[model samples]
Target: MTTTGTEIPGPAGLPLLGSMLDLKRDSLGTYLHAQREHGDVVRITAGPPGLRVEIYGVFSAEGAQQVLATESANFRKDNPFYEEVRQSFGNGLLTSQDTDYLRQRRLVQPLFTRRRVDGYAASITDETSAMLATWRNAPDATVDVAAETTRLTLRAVARILFGVDVESAVDVVQRSFPIIGEYTLTRGYSPANFPRSWPTPANRRATAAMDELYAECDRIIEKRRADGDAAMGEDLLTLLTHAESDEDTPLDASEVRDQVLVFLLAGHETTATSLAFALHLLARHPEEQTRAREEVVRVLADGRVPGAADLDALPYLTKVLKEAMRLYPAGPVVGRQAVAASEIDGHTIPAGATVVVAPWVTHRHPRYWDEPERFDPERFTPEREKARPRYAWFPFGGGPRACIGQHFSMLESVLALAMILQEYELEAVDVEVPVSTGITLRAAGPARCVLRPVGRGTGPA
Candidate 1:
C-alpha cells in the first residue's frame, strides 16, 4: 500500500515513439494488453518522441471509483487533450472545468428534471414511429440500422429539445458530425498533427463543417427569438435562453449557443450509437430479441406506443440496453488530469499526470464480470447489480461530471427500442460489425439489417 511511482509496473515502450504507435494503431487493444500484463493501474507513454506524455490507465472498478468519485476533486478536466473539444464545442458543460463547470451545471440542471424529461416521451415515440414508417416502405432491403437510428435520435433531439423541425438540417449534420468528431479525436490524441490554425485540407474541411453547424444553431436560436413568447416552450433552448442563476445573472448569447451545440451533439450521438449497438446485439441473439419483444407486446397489448410510465414495466428492454452498453459503452473512455499528487491502489499519481478510466476495459475486467465477454442481460438484474460494486458497471460514467442527459438518453433509447420491436423484426445482414472509437464508440461501418414487417404487414395505425 506504499505510495511509490516507480513501484507501478508497465511495458517499456520502444525508444522515442514509446507507445504512441500502439495507441494510434489500436487504443482498445493497447489498454487491454496493459491491463492483462500490469494489473489495474499501468503507465504508458503517448504524444511524439520529443514530447512524450505519460498517462496511467486504470482498469479496475476500485480504481475507477477513486478517479471518478472519492478522489474526484483532486482530479480536474483541465488537460491539453480537452483543448481540442473546447475549440469545437466551446466551454460547454462537457468540457468545462472548476467554477465555470459548476455554474453551468447549476444553470442547466433544471432542464433535465424528471418532469421535464417525462414530457419528451411522446416526442420520442412519435419520432421512432415516423422512422419505422420509412423503414416499412422498404422492408426487404438491407437497411443501415446504424444510420437510421442516428437519424431518428437526431430528429427527436432537435424537435423535443429545440422545439424546431430540423428535417432539412439532418443531411448537413450527418455529413459534418463524423468529420468533426474524427478531427477532434486526431487533435486530441495526436497533438503532433498540423496545428488547427493551419489551412490544411483536413483542417479546412473540419472548419467548414463546424461553421455549418454553428450557423444552424444560430438559425434555430434566431427563429425561436423571432417567434417571441409563442416559441417559449419547455424545450432546452428556451430553458437555456431564459435560465438565470440565484443572483439573477443570465447566460450570454455565446454561452447559450455553446450549450445548445453541446446538447445537440452529445444528446443525440451517444444515444444513437448505443441504440445501434443494442439492435445489432439483438439481431444476433434471436432468443434474447424474442424475449424482449414478448415483454413489449405483453405491456402494450392494446398496440399503444410506449410512454415514460411504461418504462418500469419494460425491464428486459432496459437490461438489453444495459448489457449492450456494457459490451460497447458509447463513451468508452473517460480522462482526468490529477490536479494534485494522489495515491490510488497504493500507486503514486504525480501532480499533472493524466488518469484514464476506460469503461471499455473495466466493464470487461475478469475480476468483476462473470463470463466477461458474453452478452448476458441477466447481469443487470436488480439482485445481481446490487451484489457488485457501484463502479463495476458505469456506462454513463460516475460523479458530478457524469452525463447530464442520462435520463433523457435512457427514455429515448427504451421507447425507440420498444416501438421498433413492436413494428418490425430485424435480421442481421452482417453480425460481425467492427467497432471504431474516436470521441465515442460506434460501428466501424453501417450495421446492415434486413427488416421484416410484423404480422400486420403495414405501418402502425
Candidate 2:
C-alpha cells in the first residue's frame, strides 16, 4: 500500500489544462473520484501543465492524522489557497501560521471558552424565536430555508459576538461574502504563474467586496471605541478591544479589524449553511424529523424554549446535526503546505507540496464509515463514535489549528434547530439540494421547503 513520491497514481489529464478544468467544474466530484480510483494518497496536478501545483489528496483518517496532528508541526498554512485568503482577511487566526497564529489565537481564546460562549444561550434562543415568529407571519408556507437561516445566524452572531445589532450590515455581508469566497477559490486553483494583481472582472469584484467589508469592520471598531468601556456589553467585541496578552499590548486597530472580519465571516456563514443542510435533511426524512421533534417536546414539556441548559437533554437533535455535518462539512477541505519533506504512510511528500485533508472525503471513506452516503444520526452516538479514529469524524478539523469557535457554533446550532423543530415541520420540495464548494460547502440552490406549523395548531391557510 505504500508508495514513493514518483509512484503515486493519479488521473491523467490534458496536455495543458492538467485537470484544472475538471477541478473547477466539479471539485467535490473530482476529489471523490480521485480517492475512489487512486487510493488514499492521490496526486492531483492542477493548473497549466508547465505551471501546475501538485496537490496530494489525503482521503484516509491515517493520512489526515499525519497532516493535521502527528506531523502537523512540519506543515504550515502558507499555501497557494491561504495566500488568497490572507489577501482579503489579513493574518487572522484562520490564515496565519507559526508565531503569528499562536499569538492571535491566544488573544482570542478567552472569548470562546466554554463558560463564556455558554452565556450567549439566551441571545441565541431569542434570535431563533424571533426568526420563527417572522416565518409564522409570512403569507407563503414554503420558504427558502437557506436564506432564512443565513438571516437568523447573521443577526444572532452580530448581537451576541459584536454587541451590536447589524441588521443593515447583514445585507451587505451576505451579498459580498460569496463574491470574496469565489475569488479566493479561483485564485487558489489558478495557474501558479498567473498574476493575482491582474485586473480581471472577478479580481476587481473581489477587491471591491474586500474593501467594503473592511470599511464596515472599521466603522464597528470605531463605534465601540467611542462608546468606551461603560457602553461595552458582554459580547466578543468588548473582549477583543480590551484583551491583553502576556506581552501586555492590546490588539491594534488593524488586528482588531482583521479579527472582526474573520469572526464575522466564519461565525455566521458556516453555522447558517450547516443549519440549512440540517433542515434539508430533516425534511427529506420525516421519521427522523419526528424523532427530533418528539425529543424537543419531551424535554421542553414545561413549554419553555430550549436554551444552553437543555442541550444535553436533546441528544437526537444533536445527533442529526452532527450527521449532517459529517455528510456536508462546512469547510469540506482543510489544506496545509509541507514546510519540509514529509512521509505519510510511506508515501513521500516533497517539500512545499500542498497536502489536502478533506473531511468531505475522509468522513465518507468506506473503510471508516458504514453506508457512507446514508443519513444516519446514530453514527454519532458516543458508543459508535468511540469505535472510530479521532480524525475519522472531524467536522471542526483536528490538531491545535482546529476551529476556535466550535463550541459556540455547536451551541448556537443546537438552540436554533430545537426552536425551529418546536414551531415548524419542513417538507422538502427538492430531495437533493445541490452543493457549491467555495471557501465553504453551501447549498448551491434554494433548499425550498414547505413549513407546516406544529402542535401550536396554526396550519397553513
Candidate 3:
C-alpha cells in the first residue's frame, strides 16, 4: 500500500484560513472545482498551522473503490463528521466501526435480506396510494414534489419500523430530526465550537431534540417488548428487539434504540431524495416520463401496486431511478480518516488525514460519463452498465459497509414511481430545483409539479 510519490496538488489559500472559507461557501462546488483543477487526488488544507486540517480528495472511480472497498479497513470512519453524527444519533450501523460494526451488521443483516425487505412492499404501496389520494385533492392539481415525497417516505418507513406505534414515532421524527441534522452539520465542519454542554441556544435545541427522539424510541421499544410482539409480526422494530446472530447475543435496549435511529434516518431521507429528484427529472423531460409511464402501465396494469416481485419486471422505470440517483446522490460526500500513509492514484495520502469520496463528483467524472449532466436512463441499460467501473455510479456506497437497506430503498422507489405515474401525468412547474447537502442531499427550493390524470387509453384510470 505504500509507495513513494509526488506531493499532492490543490488550491492555494490565504494564510491561516486555508480553503475554509471556500468550503464553507459551497462544499459541493469546492469539491467539483478541486477535481476539475487539480486532478483526482488533491490535498485540501484548512485552519491555521497549529490546528491545521488537511483533507485528501479521491475523485476517480478507481480511487473511490480503494477508499470505500479495497482498502476500506485502513480508511476508518474516524472523521469529524462521523463523530458528530454518532454524538447526535448514537453509534449504530452508520457510525460504528471495528468489532462493534461487525456485530451490529451481523445481527441486522438477516432483517434486510431481499425476501424480508420485499415483504414491506405492501407498506410502501399503501403509503404511496395515500399520498396520491391527497394529490387528487390538491388545488390546480399541483404539488411540491420534494415536500410530498418527504412525507410519503417518512410515513412509510415509520409504519414499517414501528408497526402499531408508528404514529408516536412519526411525530417525534418529523419534529426532531431536522434540528439534529442541521446542528450536526454546523458542528461537524467547524474546527472549533461551543461544547454541547454549553447552554448555547443551538446546543440546547439540539439536546432537546435528541432527548425527545430518544424518549420516543425507548417508549416504543418498551411497548413492543411488554406486548410480546416480537413473535406476533416481523416488523423491523420487533425483529431488532429479538435480533441475534449465530454466536452473538441479542441487542439490549440502548443498542436497539441506536439501530432504530439509524434506520429512521437512513430509510426515509435517502429514498425521499431519490423519489423527489426522479419525479422532478421526469417532469422536466416529457419524453422520458412518457417512456417510463409506458413501462409502468405494462407492468402494473389496472393500477395494481408493484410488489417486490414486480420490480424486475419494470426495467426501464428502474433505469430512470438509477439515472436520477446518479445526478443527485442522497449521500453526496462520504468521509473517512486514513489509518496509514497510502498511495492512491499515484498520490500519497498521509496517516490521520481526512479522506473524501464524493459521489457528487465521481458520478459526474468526465472520463466515465458522456454528457454527465444529461438525464439519460439508457446509460444504465445492462450493456452500458457493464462497460463502466463499479464505483463509477455508486449512490448507496460500496464495499462491506455499503448501505444495508439498499434493496428496500429500490423497492420503495420503484413501487412509488409506478403507482404515481400509473394514475397521473406530470409536468414540471419548476425544472431546475436548487440542491444542497445536509445529512443527505436536500432541495434548496420547491420542486413543483403539475399533475393531470392520465387519459384512459394512456394508463389505468
Off by over 4 Å in 1: 1-3, 456-461
Q: lDDT tens string, model 3, 398-458? A: 9999999999999999999999998888888997899978989989899998887988443
Best by lDDT: 3
Error of 1 at 45 (Å): 1.6
lDDT of 3 at 335: 95
What would the TM-scores of all predictions be?
A: 0.95, 0.95, 0.97
> How many Å off is the CA of 331 in candidate 2?
0.7
Q: Which segments of candidate 2 are over 4 A away from where they belong? A: 192-200, 456-461
Lowest-lDDT window of 10 residues in candidate 2? 187-196
Q: Candidate 2 residues 334-422, lDDT tens each?
A: 88888888878668888888889889999899987888999999998999999998889898888888899998888999989988888
Best by TM-score: 3
Q: Give the clash count for each candidate.
A: 0, 0, 0
Model 1 lDDT per residue over 1-461, tens place: 65556567787888777888888888888998899899888888866666888888888898899899998898888776788888887789988888788888888998899888999998888889888878757645557888888889988888775665566556667778888988888788875678778899999999999999888777777777788788878777887888878854677778888888788788888999889989988988889999999999999999898999999999999999999989989888888999888888778888888889999999999888988889899999899999898898888888878888899999999999999899777788887888888788877887888776677553332
Candidate 3: what lDDT?
A: 0.91
> Which residue pairs collide in model 1, if any?
none
